[model samples]
Target: MWRAEESKEAYEELKKKLMEGLRENEKIESILKALKLFNSRKDRIFKEVDDLEELREKIRRAKEEVIENLDEYIEKAVKKMEENLCKVYLAKDAEEARRIVRGIVGDAKLVVKSKSNACREIGIVDYLESQGIKVVETDLADRVVQLLGEEECHPVVPAIHISKEKWSEAFSKETGRDVPPDAQAITDASREGVRRAIMSAEVGITGANAIVAETGTIITVENEGNISLVSRVPPKHIVIAGINKIVPTLEDGLNIAEATTLFGTGQRFGAYVSFITGPSRTVDVGLETTIGLHGAQEVHVVLIDNGRRDAIRDGMKEMLYCLNCGSCLASCPIYMSIGEKYSCGYFGGIGLSFGAYIFGAQRAFVDGLGFCTDCGACSEKCPAKISSNDLVREIRRRAWERFGLLLPPHKKIRDAILETGNPFGEPPEKRGEWMKSN
Candidate 1:
C-alpha cells in the first residue's frame, strides 16, 4: 500500500473488491477436503528430502542454463534427435503444431495420449478428435476425466475433483462393464479399458518431461506405467513438447524428472521413467537394426513454440521454468477453496502466463484471470520458484492494455462503486440496516 504505485494499488483494490463479494461454494467443499488430504500425503512424501534447497538449486541452474540459451539448446536438441532418426518439427504456434500432428497422424483412426500440459495447452486431443480421429487418454485419472467429460483441475491428479464412486459410474457407463464403487474395481476396469485402447490404437502421443539436448533423449516420468505403454505400444509415437522442456543433457533432464515426481506426487522415483533416444530398435539379429521392437517405429517430435519463445523474449522467462508439477495449484488457497472457479483448467496464475505469453490475452482473460487473490502461496509452493503474483500482474497489465481485460462482473462492480459507492447495488441508505440492528 505504501508503494505509491497506481497499478499495484489499483490491482490490490480490485482484488479487494472481488474478494469482498466471495460466497460459499458448496460444490468445492468435498473437493477441498480431498485436496487437503492429498497435500498431506504429498507433504509426508516430501518430508524425507535431505537438502531440498540444494536439489532445487541444481534444478534451477540446469533450467536457467537452458532458458538462457534456449535457442541454442533447441537447435542442439533438434540436430541430435534428427541424427537419432526421429523426425523433428518446430511449430511456431499451437495451430501449426496441431497441423503438423495431423499430418504425422494422417489416416490414423485411433490414437492414445498420456497426460500432458502442452497437449492440454494446445487442445491437441480435442483438435485431433475434431478431425474424426479418436484420441483416448491413457493416464488413469486422465482417462477417467475424459470418460467423465470433465476438465482437469490439477495437472498431476486431473481427476481428483471426481470421487471414486463417480469414476466407477463413468467407467461402468463407458465400458459397459460391472465396475463397483470400490477403488480396486474402478482401477481394474479403467486399466482394462486403457489396455484395450493401447492395443488397438494406431499411434501414441505424449508430452515430454524433458528433452535432453546432448543425447536427444525424451524423458517422461509416471507412476501408473501407462505413459510407458501409451508412448510405446503403438507403431507411431508423436511427442508434443514445449521448447521450454529442453535441457542441456540427460542428467539435467533426469533431475527435472526427479523433481517433477517428487513434488508432483511425492514419489521419489516414479514407477516408470522412460528415456526415449529414438523409436525402439533391435540390432541383435544379423547385426541388422530393426525398428519397432515392442515400441513405436515412427517417432515424431513436435517442439512447440506456442509462446514459449515469446515468454523468453518478453522477459517472462520464469514461466518457461515451470515443471508442470501442479504444486502451486495444490498450495494456492484460492484454488483449494473454489477449485476451477478461481481459474479454469490451465488458466490461473501459470495458466494465465500460458495464456498471456503464448495464447494471447484474449485466450486467457476469457477465464477471468482476475480471480487470483495474490496471496503468493502459489509462488511459495512452486518448486521452480516462479512468481505468479508478478506474472499475474503483468498478464493483467498487458491484457488491460490490449482489450481492457476487465471481466463483466468486475465492470459491474466498477459501475456499482461509481454510482452507489458500494459493490452491492442496494439502496445506499439500506447499507446501514444491519449495523442498526446490531
Candidate 2:
C-alpha cells in the first residue's frame, strides 16, 4: 500500500515536528514528570488490590494458552461470529485486508473511519485513496491531522504535538472562514468537519480494542464520540483489528479494556464504549427480522495477522497484548525528545519493535537508538509492563546482525567504553583533573 521510503520520510517529518513542539530544557523534565504521575497513579490504583499480581499472572497464562492454541481459538471465533450473521475474514497480510475492504466498499465515494492505529499501520488511507474512495477520519484528533496532511505524532492524542494556534490556522484554511485561536473555536471547527463526514459516509471503518471470542462482540473505547458516530451513522461498518486483540470471553475483554483505559489515559472509563455484536437486528413486528435500523446494517470484521503470528512465535508475544493506550509514548524520554520520528509505525516503544520487523531495521533506524536514554520510564508506566527499552536494545542488536549497520554516535561511544572505562576515553587521572583545577 505505502512504500517503505515514504513511511520513513513521514516518520522523520513527524519527529521533527514533535521536537519543535518541546522546549530544549523541558523535554526530559516533562517526560519524567509524566512518568512520575503515571507511576504514582498505577501504584495507587493497584496498591490495595491484593490479587493484582495474581491477576497479571493469570492474564499472562491465559494469553499464552490462547496463543498456543491459536488455530482453535480463531476457528471458534469465526464460527461464533458467522453464527451471528456477521461476516468474518482472516487476512494474512495488509494486501489481503486492503483488498477485502476495497471489495466491500466497491465504488463508494465517501467512507468515515474511527481512530484506528491498526488501519494506519496497514496504510488503509493510502490504499483506499488508490481505489478512488474518499476516506475521511472522523475522530477529531485524526481529522485535524488529516486536514493538515500529516502523520499522527501520538497514538492517543494524534494532534497533541500540534499547538492550538496551528490548529486554528489549519481550520481557517480548510473552512475558508475566520477562526479564533481559542480551544473552543478549534474544537467546534474540528467537530463540525468530522460530523459532516460521519453523516454522509457510506461505509465506516474502526479498530477494535478487544474482540470477545465467546460472545462474538467487538469492543471499542474512545474519549471522543466519533467512534459511536462512525459505527452508527454509516450503512456498512468494517472493523480491522490485529488477531492478538481477541480474548476468550466478554468479561476478559472488559477487564483488558478497563485496565487499558485507566492506565492509558488516566480515566476511570472512556466516554463512549461501544460493544457491537453482529449487525443491528430486531425481530419485533410479526416475527420479521430487521437489520440496520438503529446502526449499521452490515458488519464485517477482519482479523489481520500481518506479522503478529511471527512475533508471537519469536517470543515477542507480549507486544500483542498492547491495548494501544499510548501511555508509554507519553512517558518515553526518547519519544518526548524526538517526538514521532523515534519509530516508524504506531509510535513509542512498541512501535520501535514493530517497525524493526515490519519496516526492517535499516529503513526504521534513527540515531543509532541513542534517541532512547534507557530511563525505563516507558516500561514503568506501561500497564502491560512491555519492557520497551529492552526491546529497543534487542532491535538494535538485530539491526547489526541483519544489515551490519551500527548506530552512529552510540557505536563510537560503545567502542570508547569498551576500550576504556569512560565513554570519553579520557585518561583515568584526567577524570578528576578538571575538578581539581576548577
User: What TM-score would every model get versus the actual structure?
Assistant: 0.86, 0.83
lDDT of 1 by residue, 81-186 (tens): 9988899999998899999999999999999999898898788988998999999899988888888787666777776668767888998997797788998888
Q: Candidate 2 versus the native: TM-score?
A: 0.83
Per-residue lDDT of 26-67 in model 2, one digit per residue for the tens?
444444555466557766766655666555555555566567
The parts of candidate 2 lying over 4 Å away from their true place are 1-62, 366-370, 408-438
Instruction: Kindly report which residue stretches of model 1 are placed more than 4 angstroms away from their true locations once superposed.
Output: 1-27, 344-347, 406-438
- How large an RMSD does model 1 have? 6.2
Locate the minimum summed-lDDT window of 10 residues in model 1: 1-10
Q: Highest lDDT, which number?
A: 1
Flag clash pairs in model 2. Answer: 15-341
Query: Among all windows of ten consecutive residues in candidate 2, which has the lowest summed lDDT?
Result: 23-32
Q: What is the lDDT of residue 163 in candidate 1?
A: 75
Superposed by TM-score, candidate 1 places the C-alpha of residue 86 at a distance from the truth, in angstroms, of: 0.8
